[model samples]
Target chain A: MTKSLKTVQLSHGGGGKEMDQLIKSVFFEAFNNPILCSEEDAAKLHLSGPVAFTTDSFTVAPLFFAGGNIGKLAIAGTVNDLAMMAAQPEYLSCSFIIEEGFAIDDLVTIVNSMAAELHQSGARIVCGDTKVVPKGCADGLFINTTGIGRIIYPDVSANNIVAGDAIIVSRDIGRHGATILMAREGLALESELTSDCATLWPIVEQLIAANIPIHAMRDATRGGLSAVLNEWAKASNIGIDVNESAIPVADEVKGLCELFGFEPFDLANEGTFIIALPQAIAQGAIEVMQRYGHCQQAAIIGHATSAHSGKVVLTTPWGSHRYLDLPQGELLPRIC
Target chain B: MTKSLKTVQLSHGGGGKEMDQLIKSVFFEAFNNPILCSEEDAAKLHLSGPVAFTTDSFTVAPLFFAGGNIGKLAIAGTVNDLAMMAAQPEYLSCSFIIEEGFAIDDLVTIVNSMAAELHQSGARIVCGDTKVVPKGCADGLFINTTGIGRIIYPDVSANNIVAGDAIIVSRDIGRHGATILMAREGLALESELTSDCATLWPIVEQLIAANIPIHAMRDATRGGLSAVLNEWAKASNIGIDVNESAIPVADEVKGLCELFGFEPFDLANEGTFIIALPQAIAQGAIEVMQRYGHCQQAAIIGHATSAHSGKVVLTTPWGSHRYLDLPQGELLPRIC
Candidate 1:
């Protein structure tokens, strides 16, 4: 039997003993289920009406990073995107571009992380493919995942959001970005931050179960909160006025941002989220999100408006408001 | 406006002028669809019924070459995989990993090529992402695409293949492989044999429309026809007898294989396919395939048998037979 924890080689792509060993040791162990165990090139399944489809690719540098690895990021990224659309993530396909000579132990660790994350989030990886490149041709690993889900709710999209809708954030901002920066900079802080990389499906499911009319939902990702808010404003053809005091920022994150001369709002986030709910139910939504997030900081940070269409204005603590645009360019590289 | 034929730089990932230019010059033009034109982070759509999902990563070395680039191959590769499963190619997600300092023009060319290919195949690239790695961490470019298509048929699986089925090869074997070899080795043939990297969805759609019950199907990719056939035989616990004379091979590929002491059967094929059907419907299926291939060279190269179980035996013209097995390893690295 091939040893399980050695560095991986091109032999793994040969579809022979080494390949089998790798699958059994890593992917199969992490992603195994009745459907995945079949190991077909495509997955076949029975389904009901109104399906939702979403796909994402994860290319986090160092593969194994400070707070989370590429595997968790891959699963969480797609599942969160689906949740934002009010779709229950059902099946997923994982494709890997593995740099030859990557350590098997690292691959196994990453795969195991993915399995744990999937199990926790109630998502399954149903089909997958793996490819290897010459040692110097790629980083240790890059993963791309595609997901399919059933849209229990027929009405879901940014188009559904109305001008009077109220915007609610699930929790504090900038933890994911802060953790990544700290990891990269090797900076020590009074309060070490962990990524808010938890799955939002449960929270989304809860909201749907309560029968709330959601106009729009999005997880603050590459562009951060400001980017997603600006995109929502633009996409919905409405204006949003957010109070900086109401936007939840961890005190430590605020301190770190000030020191680093970065705006926490524009930083990358993996765990934070934003939701647009009917104005009348905004407070109730915040209450529920606080119960789930266990963060007292959940707040009604902004309100959607009819005037000054497609722009987001942030009201500063000094009473002056400034237009908050989507991330203009690269703030941090490889945050995902 | 970004010029169409300019070099792509790392700044394309920055969501600035380069990024807008990249999307406008290539994706907007080739696809020419409503969804792709929006150029949003996600593509919203309507859907119904069961769906088939598949993902593939393309890390072919020498990213740019004579026949196709990584982008086109990336789209065509996933679309073809979906078609092989008898699914209507609907949506695709493209993710890129760029080695820093790679050419921006090459990236644009690749994206345009992919757009043209996807448009031709009747598939749309709705969602995509980009990432960059420091130089030496990757080859110039690597692309991973994941696709979701509706399953138009009720049943499709390699397990559906029975003990006695006819196997067909759409056309000449190893053109894709030989072309890669010629480019890599600089071995000139009598005529240029560019890789046949076209999408097979049209031909597949025609086959499905013919209402033939295909027991099994597969693209003879990395490990080649021999590898796929062996996998089917093992999965179904049956034996296969292939007619060596009936097996189509281009003269250039044959000459190179002989000179390099290689077997055409074991080489990677980017454009060819392998399919299994009941013996009675085999000829009809072949007719259906040829009608769309525009290359009327579909041939019955083999039959599934109960004897010599779990093996692929090739019958030579001289009445001699040779046992063919799955390819042991890569004949060429990153040949798509």
Candidate 2:
């Protein structure tokens, strides 16, 4: 095949010879596997017993950001959802909608990022679909990923949190939202401030393997830490008491939030996660988490309490308390 | 909740209270079910044995056509892939990328179409994600659906077609492609011509119930009949002899093809499917398929042969024959 065109055309998605060549040179080379190479309408798998199914769509602005591109985020986002359910990320279905005239080289770069991210979780993209629309019909590219995995640890539910359980933050919060804000504004920060976009299967697998009695776990994505806490409080019907000073927020994120007039707790974090477990095992869990580079700032930020059921209470360092409500308005669009 | 805004805002996908309200009022009510109501990061499914996984992204232009909208096409397209593999469509993940300022009422209508189409397959949309881009960032709306189903019948491979097997189409060809062309061109026809977009699970279920010996099955979506036949011939390494006159094409479709100087075999069909089976079972399959209202025109158009292996030969009514090649260039974009 000759490399005459630098950008994708309608013919690239027309289900013709050009489309076949695009799949072979791009998608097939990056996501090579026996099942995918079969090129069947559907991929066949021998899945048995309980499974975890999840999905996410990535349409972030400026397709490339400080820490990762949309393709990496697409893979990590869906894989993290499965890992939150104590499922080992196994297979994923990737679908892309690209605008006509999108640079083929840029697409290849994004796809390669996706392949690199999948390596961290040992997940495979078995089946996929691609569609190209007119140039003005879409901005650039949007990706949707749906994942299925075997449930390694069952009954990991948000409704399972109970009084006396400790809530732990996996890492510093709000990096993703802050990074995107800076990228959109064309800011050059003095310190390295990047989105913490990464696959969480490794850390989650460690927790499951350690036999920790995890009550609930979730990644703080769109609505950030605030939304996760509020949902957990409502679902578990328990009150959560937080120590404001303990939650880790990097100085760069705090600075960006101050400049943007936003709350760090309400901003997104791609790799940050919240875990609920028995108070006795909080230290052990933190130690295990800190072994990973991304989890260096892990700390216990809150605990489930019996008072004021179905609400999250935040205590300031100066001894004042207030409800950290679920985000009410648009914090930021396309943060994930 | 007040029905104040007629259009969707960026806040509706901001992972806040507005987004929650939108979900409850629109998607939740239409796709109400126990699994979807769990409100977890992922849906827990108890799947066992062999399973089929597939994905499709629907960027169909105009959003709505005579018989279906993008939502209906999204569900049917993925479900049909599983049904073609003899898999019982069960679970699906739906993701949407909506443009800001898109009408909320139109979104609801499209979503309702999706729910209605799911009834034909008994497949549930268990987990979903929604995102909103700024106005002009996307063209109204786009949807991606990924489906998983249990494989009731195994080894139905495209490469399994052998000599003496008959090729049967479930319904008339080219209706879907022509319908979109007419809609885009704003043409007025005397007779109604609508897309064949529909769920094929019901008809496929009946065929499975009757124990027809199916060797290969596929839907002629983007590249239509010519793509399927050419692919089948190459994959099976067998010659395919098609009686061009025996293939069914609706009057409206034939007229549109004539006007556009396009071949009917190169047109798309969303709901239509092709099956390969022993000559002895061809009539049995056709009888079961024609029982469906949309499948009244079901017929066998070709047979697998040993002569001219890896080629699809078309026999005309006037005693002429030629090779039917796979579609080339961009016949249509975003047809499904």
Candidate 3:
């Protein structure tokens, strides 16, 4: 093969002449198919009735980093989205944004990582796209993911969320964000921290096995407790009141945030969640979360309310109370 | 407030400090959820049976392409995915990867387009995420999408594909790809080429209304017709032989491909399909497709076989036989 031009260029990502050339030279020849040839905007089929869909993007820097890579993030992000709906994710597709001169090895690492994660999630990588930009236009790698999960639950909806619901969180908050920050920032901390990047379907199975009625559930991510609560409040047209001290946070997280001027509540957290259920069933939900070694710190941090409207308030240890607000900005980008 | 950074950086994309800064500064503040907090590889939920799933990604370069933009692509891709599966796409989540210094107008345009598309598709943007990257290390924009659709077909699977099945196409091949190629390549031509980007759920509804015994179906995408056939071959474990003369390709596409060194059989198509039906229902199927407007060029190019053993072969204009292969690599990468 001729080394036409060793470096990636904006055209590669432009979907123009250069992009056509790269794809024809590499991908089309390798993956040739008639359906792929027409290159329409969306695939059409004769499939009918009830479908699940999802999307995600990986902005992981360095492309290849510790624990996992961009490709892995691509798969995990979308698969997790589907799982959040209590659906079994089945299909996945992705788009890639690569800066010029991005290492092909790094791309491969990302792809393989995605493959591994997809396999673990029980999903198939059915469709995808890739683009390359100018060298000075982008970081080495970025990936966007979309996934579809089979609709196993027909009755579950935000409308089903009700008041007097119990709140249950799985695991500690901010592990993934804190760990990544510590690792990248080279925080000389003797305390070991790792990204809480595990999958949660197994834990979900445990909860479902309890045969309990859970009103609503959400993953506590970028906005941490405040964001999740606010969303639930707006969706269910109710307020959520919480005992701040009841929530779980690690000593390491407290130390790191206070030192870095980060707020534990506003800062991002990984592998955490908030579940709304009847106050009576709150204990059962927590018991299910505890079965998973990951949820050892599960707690009932709040209850849904109808009075305060779309706001979440927390009763802090201090004499005064604090109203937790939705994270004001990007607290953490691609923690998942 | 502090001019921390306007453009995205590798650290921001990473699951670390910079990533934290980006999210804290932007997305987290806008939308927060407990599931999102889980920073785990996945957020799982327990569901009440048969489900539907779909996923899509967007990589329309220039961040503000002519026809639409990344945002529209993101939404349309997932919506269409659900539609093809015969599911009513209900909820959606969007993920974005943006480069630094991108024109805010372009972002707004993309978002507006997405909002419009979502409306047209009858889907709600229930959840989403955004990530920013360093200017030099990222593109102007990219998006990933996932959606939820309710499954309506009690009996829909590849298992029904069989020897007597007839393959019906929804429309002419090459419109979407040719138009994209022409537009992206700046190919000045007598024929104005534009993408055949349209929703097919309505047309699909018409097909189902016909009440024919439709067995297997697939959307022609990355690999085009050959890829779909290959998938059908293995999926249903049956062979299919196509008659090239019977397959339809627009004259514009033919002329454009020859001029650009492209192959109509090896391009990316988003809005084409290969549907399998019992031989008895083949003509009726085509008639139904033609009535749908989108299926005007619909043709019965092939039939399922048992003897050939999961292989797809094409009988050419020259009366010679050739095997259709899967695209080995990306074709017109990032076209979506």
Candidate 4:
């Protein structure tokens, strides 16, 4: 069926027979499930207990990028949000806004990527909406994913961090932002910096199963580590002090940041996350992350402090400390 | 704070300080709620029992139409999908993709419109995402809303339409499609036509409260009445026979359809809905709709039959019958 179409036509989103065929052949075929195939206005689910709901709209430029595409980001972004809240990712609703004349092949690749990403988190795209606008009305495509899941280990929040909590980062930072920057600059083939775009549920699940006394957890997405740490400081009314040299940054990412005059700590990491926990359990958490979560670079890089509340301070390698403020102005637009 | 900005810039979506300010000053100011203001990665919801989940992406051209804007349509559309499933609209997650340089005032207006429409169903915007693309990457703005609610009256489905069930329409159809067409064609003010863009949860809640014994319920949205009837027939494996003259069509909508060489049944309706129920209580259902649902033109227009299964036959005033097929091609794009 996909072979019959070269590019998407406006009629494919006209809510007509053409639209039905397009949906059945492309979308339904990729994200097929019993609940989705029920042909109902909405998917019916038997849910009980406290649930976590999050949504994200992916408008990453270039559509295709190193290591992952917009479709993978859409699924993993929403799933990670739920996982950060100690939620077991379950159901997701996807919506696509496509431009007329988008290539059917590219769309197939994107949808297939989304289906594969969902498998990583054991989540299902139970319902979806599609809209195709005329040429120039939109870029190639924008995907919005909203997810709901049961809160397995509740009380994980940005405001839960205590003054004595240690902050641990999963893996390296800035790969996602550097990869996108490289792609946008047409330097992708010259570098090995691929996006850390992945589903974080397995890591989160392991952390929960290990009974690490987590106070707060967050993915360093937009505004990167600086944004998340600053938000945590303000939300929890505590100061966060970090050792600059202790944080992990890939060499390629650091080189890219140097070339662009950007800070690796201020760039996004799609698959990386930060956890705040008691200092006593921080090493145990890191061990679990490395041994079972597949996060070999996981390390404790900071700690919450009562002094200088509502601030994030970073101590440089030379012992000079300065505030790590929330990123200001535009670093990158449509990076994810 | 909104007065400080004339237009949205790429920085507003950079996942930085500017984006945070924009979100708090605009989105949070309008859709303020405890859950949304919690500042967590995901909104926590305590949901139980059978739940209905649906999603819709609104890329309606012109952004603002005769009766409502894209924001209102986004809210109403997802709510209607849940309502069609006999769900009590409870929570919604909204994600927006905005074009750079879009007017801040327009964004405020759209956000406020969404907040206002959400009041109709007592649903809360619990979580949301915002992305801004570079200029020309998208039109003014596009919104995707995903909703979840507990199904109050279960067993209502298209496949539940048994033979001899009465079919009823809530009110006149095609106003939404005609209004958008007029707006897009620059003929909006030439006539008094307006889109029937409204939230239908109140009407649906009333029907459920009245114990309508609804077998099937659907909003005649994109693809309109013709699509809904045909889909119901096919899903239920029953035949649907409709009286063409009995289906209400406002004079303005009819005139516009005539001018455009389109069929009223094929045009869209945002607020309008069709229902299938026991023939014995058809009049009672109409009375409930007219008196309490504010559907003054509510009337019985058809019934399900054992013959001609999987087909929708429309009886003309001339005593001729023709199959009412699902709309075949583009009638109007971005009709919402």
Candidate 5:
């Protein structure tokens, strides 16, 4: 019967026959697992040790994007939060607020992308809820994913950073923010830029296995490299000095930032992350990241300092230094 | 700076200064807890044993209702799902997707309601996220809450119902649905009706403490009593028989159901729940519910049977029997 309908109707989320059918045919089919298939009021899980819990809501416009879609971002974003805490991601709960008359084909594509992304972290979607609003009440769709994982490397924390700790970037930045701008501005045909929206669990897992002794690890998601560094500086009550030339940025992203008058440091990155560790082991960590984690562009961009506490200073290529403040106003809305 | 603006701006969700100020003043101030104040990517929790996890998204139109707002419903809905599994509501993660230009006063009121509701189950909002969409991209706001708790009574499940089990209703039904309908229709001044929106943990805790052998337990949410009963029958592969006269319904609910030509059994209940237990303990369960759960009208309305497997048969007051199939199409959208 669902095949007879081209789009999702209000009845599909009415908690009745049509709702059950849609969940079984779409969500259950894509995310088939014993825990979810049990169909209880809540999922029963066996958890122990220090558990890391986090949540994120994705309202990215144009659900479909160049490199990934909202579904992929929803999964990767929550899983990456766990990974940032040096946790082993295990379970996730997904809730969808869909608009009436959304295309069933697009829903399928999104669900399939979610299923594929889950494979990167070995996390299972255990329980979920669905609701549908009238057409004008919502955009296309919004997804909220909450995740739980066991903290394997328990010493990692933002406040743990200290003087002499080297700051490292996982990869090139600003691609995700620039890509979204391009998509929204109808400049998709002008360049081949794509969002760096990949799951970071594999890379994080390797670093943990290598005993990197990371002090802090965080994904540069919403406010990019500047946000993470500035937060760490304020949280740790220390100063951070960066060699601006060491920070990686793609040419297309740089060009777009220049054209739009946006800073690359303020742009967002879905997959890129920053790390803080002892300078003695920074080179070793970078080597492990490149050799085993496949983060070929990973580099030590900066280091913690005792001067100018609670501030982040950037050294330009011409040897001039300036404060890299936390982004103040709206950079780009719904970039995630 | 935020005091100057009466409404939320797109910059408040931009992951920068304005967003930080809003979060600190609104969410952090109300939900002040050590874990949440730690300012980490994920909250670290020590969860042991079999954990119950559930998620729900609240998109109830007319954000503020007679009895409760979306904030109260969001917390109670997810907490009830865990309580139905005989779990101790412990940690919760909340995510908000707000539309731009929404009133700031309304947002503060909603957050305060959430903080008050969390006290009902002693659950803490350990982590959360906020995202804002452009004006008209979404309704006023939507809240997603995901909860996790340790299962104390692990035997409760929808598939655990068996032959000769008594069916009980915790309280009168259809109040929440009727109340919302009345609100949407601008008839709030005509009657003194209120939504039965409440946290069910206190009642469920009393039942567990009394050692009532609960075979299956579930909240009567969307699709209402009929949906839960039908799902139980199919899951347990058993038949259920209900005496229509034994069910409880408020006068206002009955009046509204008749006016709208809708079955009371098909209307949703925010706080009411269904239980399956042995006939021998049925009277004791009702006593516990009434004395401790404050369920004045709790009653045993039906029993599970071996005949007519996988179906629910309701006996009318006039002595006629008919199948109470699941609600087929959309009854009311965005009721929760």
Candidate 6:
């Protein structure tokens, strides 16, 4: 009976003895905390005042990625959401849906990655649940993380961007998207091109500590920079004019986009983000961000305007302008 | 392109135009609320003092089940977690992982079911995310719900179960597990056997409102009544003596268990719960629970004792005593 339990079986998620053993030996040992070890139905917490709540289900393909794996993404993804809201991430709930026969070793590796990533934001996995499906019923594994944090900076909204606000890209665009594309397509790159899938809490915390009047902040995930700019334009009822030449894109990302007929602005990004603030303080924000290695390439890419409300206008290197619309069709699936 | 849009496509989860349309027309319309429509990265909440946080992932096979579908279970399961802690269910985050080519109509049905279930506990889905995987990579769909609620009563925990505490099962056991088994095995029982899938917040609210001194409360979900009792025994360092005949088991469940060599006490349940309270208030708690139609069969099936600490002793109909250990092996997979 013990021999057959080398890999996770249906019994491991059945809330029985096998499940108890797996949770204790794996999850409890990795994510040890007072609230979690209490074994209550729900984790008791002492959250007060304004809190930020968010959820994300990570289904990134090729669980082991170039820079990080799905477990790292799961923790950082949800933690970034709270950070984007200018909140200090505090608590998270991690749930897993595993397919039967998934290697126990792989599961352990993924869980350990999650525990390591949690330290990046000082967040705790306070509560969780697990479900397992039969073989072929699900891909190797999928993780869902829900996070809550205290909102230290309030009134930061997509609708809060004003006409004089400046747009800043945190780092080089499309590295994450291009990295995943390369990984999936088996492309061998000469340079050390990896995913920008790091936790943004450090940089975001720095910005708040530096006292930048941040109007809006968001990670350029999923629909990428173009989607974020367009949504901001529509939500804040302002026109956004971006300089095409100023937005930084890595050489490898540019090469992949050209080869795959994808736009750098249209692909997904896991770790990169966009920030909007009053133009007077934009340079200060850039200086604060540039102190970090990941944000060394941060630059002012655009500005909000009243000319073309509900739209984003891109000024090309040739001094001609065109609308940068929201991305329409599927570019890459399971990028996150 | 429109011709192929009858079912959910990969684009619906691509974080692009199609994904936006799907969210607006499907989820937004069904779960319409001010917080959700705000379109922020994280929903801003005003939770104060003590709060209860919990999460559950639902991957039930046969999305359309006997009494409820996966969506209903998703909301109820998470809400019940908070309710079990004597918390007032308030806000929830819903995330979905969908398989490509899953029926759009079925997805809508599940979403509607989720919206209906939210009304039972007055919990709003404040934030959500949707992801689509390629076909055959996953089953129909899986849902993860994380909830936060204000604690109305505190210190209700498994460790608080003291000697002289009466243990009561909210309703019949094994119905959900048996129903799923019958569905999977193609058993056409003569009796109308449906799962005991339901939202327990309404009944739980009544108990708390009546000021019952509850020591511990938990829903018998995965490992059923036996698991709950065993955990209570170990956590509180008290022996649990349950009268085997007093436990309510329907005729269909008993027949199925007898035929399949399964124990009714070890089967999964969705709506059923067990309460541990002082014997002085046990009758009052029962009266409050029995007010609901689903709890008509609620009975005091056990009592916490000092004898044989850290174990569960089950007295058979012939007065023979045996240790009812935590269940081992997989009795049912994806039962939730």
Estimate, for each residue in A19-54, the C-alpha lDDT of model 6 and write its tens digit.
888888888988999999898999999987899999
Each candidate structure's TM-score, on Cα atoms with residue i matched to residue i, is 0.93, 0.99, 0.69, 0.99, 0.99, 0.98
Candidate 6 lDDT by residue in tens digits, B1-336: 322467899999988788888988889989999999897899999988999999999999878778888999999999999999999999999999999999888898999999999999899999999999999999989999999989998969999999999999999999989888888888845558998988899998888889898899999999999899999999999999999999999999999999999999999999999999999988889999899999999999999999999999999999999999999988899998
Q: What residue runs in model 2 are displaced by over 4 Å at the alpha carbon?
A: A2-4, A189-191, B188-190
Pick the winner on TM-score between candidates 3 and 5: 5
Residue pairs whose backbone atoms clash in candidate 4: none
On residues A1-336, what C-alpha lDDT tens digit does candidate 5 reach at each position?
675689989998888999999899999999999999897989999998898999999999878888999999999999999999999999999999999999999999999999999999999999898898989899999999999999999999999999999999988899989999999999988889989998999888988888889999999999889889999999999999999999988999989999999999999899999999999999988888887433789999999999999999999989999999889888999987
RMSD to native, candidate 2 = 1.2
Colliding residue pairs in candidate 6: none
- Report clashes for each candidate as comma-separated counts: 8, 0, 107, 0, 0, 0
Give me the candidate number with maximum lDDT.
5
Worst 10 residues of 3 chain B by lDDT: B39-48
Q: Best-fitting candidate, measured by DockQ? A: 5
Candidate 5 clash pair list: none
Question: What is the DockQ for all candidates, taken in turn?
Answer: 0.49, 0.88, 0.14, 0.90, 0.91, 0.91
Candidate 3 chain A: minimum summed lDDT over ten consecutive residues — where?
A38-47
lDDT of 3 by residue, A141-203 (tens): 666666656655444445456777777778778776676667667662556665566556566
lDDT of 3 by residue, B1-336 (tens): 212454444344433344445444444333344543433223333232433445555664444433455666666667766666666666666777766565544555566677667666666664556666655545567676766555555344555678867877777776666766766676635456555566565665666778866776666655567667776777678888888888888888889878877667666566677788888888887887787666788889878888586788888988999887655444565566
lDDT of each: 0.76, 0.92, 0.63, 0.92, 0.93, 0.92
Tens digits of lDDT, candidate 4, B1-336 = 545989998889888888889989999999999999898989999999999999999999889999899999999999999999999999999988999899999999999999999999999999999899999999889999999988999989989999999999999999999999989889987888888888888888888888889999999998999999989998999999999999999998988898899999999999999999999988988888898434899999999999999999999999999999999876788777
- Which pairs of residues have clashing backbones in candidate 1? A137-B138, A196-A271, B6-B105, B7-B104, B7-B105, B8-B104, B8-B105, B9-B104
Better of 1 and 4 by lDDT: 4
Ranking by DockQ: 5, 6, 4, 2, 1, 3
**Candidate 1 vs 3: which has more DockQ:** 1
In Å, residue B79's CA in model 3 sits off its true spot by: 4.9
| Model 2 docking grade | high
